[model samples]
Every structure is written in C-alpha cells, then in structure tokens.
Target: MSLSTVQQVLARIYTDSKLRDDFLTNPDVVGISFGLNCQEIQQLSKLSRQQVDLFARSLKRKRLGEIRKLLPLTNQALGKEFNPLFFQYSETYLPTGNKKHLLDAIAFTKFLLQQLTTDNTQPVSVLDVLRYEAVRLKMFEGKRLLFCNRFYYHLETLINSLHSDSPLIPYPQPNIGIWFRLPNSQWRSLFIPFSVKRKKIFSFHRLVQKYLAIQ
Candidate 1:
C-alpha cells in the first residue's frame, strides 16, 4: 500500500468529477488503475459518495470564488453563463503550480474566448472585454509597468453598459487600451485613439497628472 499513490488517487477523486464517478461506480477497477492494492481500494471505497460529492462541490465553489475576484468585470458581464461555462472548463482542466489561481484565470479567459469564437452567440465586445481582463491579470502578476491592447469597441461605454445592464450597443470605436501601475502601486487604465501618434508629442506624465487631479 503506497501511501503517496493512495493520496494522489484521493486528490484526483476529490477534484476530478469524472474520475470520482468512475471510482464510486467501480472502486476496485479504478483503484487498480491507480496502482492501489485490495486493502487500499476497500478503504477508499468506504468513503461516502454523498460526502465526496459535497467536498467536490465545495472545492468548485472555492475555485469559482477565486475566479470571480480575479475577473469581477468579466464575471459580471457573463452573468448566468459564467458558472456553467466555468463548470465545463473545470471538468477538463485543473491548474497546478505556485500561481495556480493566476494560471487558472489566464487559462479560463482563453477558454472563454475560444468558446465565444466557436459559438458566435456572444457580442464581439465580450471577447474584447475578456482579453482586456486577461491582460490586466498578467500585468499585475508580473508587476509590469505598462500593458496595451487594441479594443474594437469603446471600453468605457462597454464597461458602463455591463455595470448598468443596459443594451450592449457599443459602436466600432477602435482604440488602444493602456494599463499602467503608479509609483505608489495603484493601477490605472485608460484608452487612446489610434490617431494619437508618437510624432504628436503627447505627454503621458501630463495625462497621468490630469487624470489624478480629476480623480
């Protein structure tokens, strides 16, 4: 009876729903596949299915909570679709590493983008919003000073619509959205039109100062 192997199987059974179901259905077979002997299999088989399911649900809720904190705007925008989509994502993927939450967020953002791309049911603005949030996550994780990405719709208008539950009628106002961290470690985000060229001698410091003054 390898304690480490049994622990590994238990971890998967707790986190992976399909494996949990299979184990509950045929514990001996599943245990054998995991290199568990007869005694270990019998011991694991004694675990109550209802209790295992409750623990798994709790784990999923924790993961969902972390994702909501990391991507509040995206979660708010998705509304009813968020939970189901995350459930689908969790079925196939389990993030690992020191920055597992961050990794999970980045992977989920890409998954959402792929899902929306294939379905074509969601507004195009949603795709941009997901990308914007993903960039923010990466920026904060890396402590990057600046990150920029192109957005097809007016970001401010889209964000406002999401907040208000108004119709998402964002026009095709393309621009570069910029996210920067201040010296005090506060983050700020804004957009600039593509028309703003380097040759125009725009003062970023002045812009930041003015934005701070207004705030």
Candidate 2:
C-alpha cells in the first residue's frame, strides 16, 4: 500500500473509536479492509494494543490542550461541562484540512453558533469572546492585516456593540480587549474590562509596530 493509505488508516484508527476498537480487537481484518497486503497486515497486527491506544489518547489530549489555549475563557465558563461537551462536539464535528489550533477553534465557534440557532437557546457570551479571539488570531493574510486599518479606526463601534442594551450582547461583556499578546510572546487574557482611550487605539498600534519591531 502507498504511504498515504497507511497514513489515512492510521489517522482513522487514531480518531475513530469504533474503528480503533475493531482494529484493536483484530488488526488483520481491519488492515486488509484498509487495503494493506498480507505483510503489512501482519506487521500492523504485531504492534501491541497499548501503543495504539496511547497514540489515540495522545491525539485527544493534544487536541484538548490546543482548545484550552485557544478558548480558555470558554472552557472555564463551561466548568465541568467542557469536557463532556468537547467529547460530543468532537465526535460530531471532526476537524480536517488545517493542523492549526486556531482553525480548530474556528470550527468549535461555528459548532456553538449552530447549536444555539438549532436550540433557540440563550446566547452564551463566551462564544462571542472565542469568535473574537479567533478572528484576531486569523488577522494576517499573506503578511497584511485582514481588516488592515479599518478595525483600529472603529474600536468605538465594536466596543459599543458589546455594551448595547440589546440582549444580543454576551453577558458580562468586557469593555476591553480580553486577550492581548504580551511582550514575552505569551498570551495574556483578562476578563475584566480595562480602560482604553479611543484616540490612542490607532497611535498605540503604530507605536507597537515601530518599537516592538513586530506585529
């Protein structure tokens, strides 16, 4: 079999529990079904179950780790419900194509939005925060900011929506940018709104670009 086929089979084994269970129970049959020849099947069957299980578990752990980093507030807001929700959400919506964690977050945000629409339930503000961060992370497209100078010029309008009397805004909507990239190259997030001068928004952005030597 081709290397791509092997990768696909291994990937399925890692992601699909039912298929992994079947493979663990009898690798020979699963391997044959995956188009592996007798030698390949035998070699695969020789691999112990524990190794396969560990690999599968590691993938889940890594995914959750990424989710925790990308959606820290959302994870904390859900509390004990986060893990179970991730279990159900991940099974139903297996992310593909992009290995970037931000892409996974974008997918999760979509899932949350759809779930809310389908259930017609109260909106969760954490999802809004997650969407905002995801967009911020996806800001650059081919070395140019996606929104360019537009967002810097419109901080007031964006902040206004967060504080609107309408129920559309997330509860406990913060008045400040909740997440910021610190100088040490770490993600620093604050739940409380911090004071920001609208006039400084554009100037500060320019100053950061010039002094920090990064964007």
* Model 2 lDDT per residue over 1-215, tens place: 88788888888888788888899898888998888998777777776778988887888878888888777655654557667666666665456675556667667766765775577553445445445655555542122222222121123333355445332333342343333454446543322232334333334454445435533
Query: What is the Cα-based lDDT of residue 53 in candidate 2?
Result: 84
lDDT, model 2: 0.59
Give candidate 1 regions above 4 Å deviation: 1-5, 143-148, 161-169, 178-215
Residue-wise C-alpha lDDT for candidate 1, range 1-215, written one tens digit per residue = 67877887887998899899999999999999988889999999999999899989998899999999998888977879999999999877787788989989988998998998899978878887788889988886776787767778888788788778776657677776667885668778777665434422336676567567877
TM-scores, all models, native as reference: 0.76, 0.57
Candidate lDDT values, in order: 0.83, 0.59
lDDT of 1: 0.83
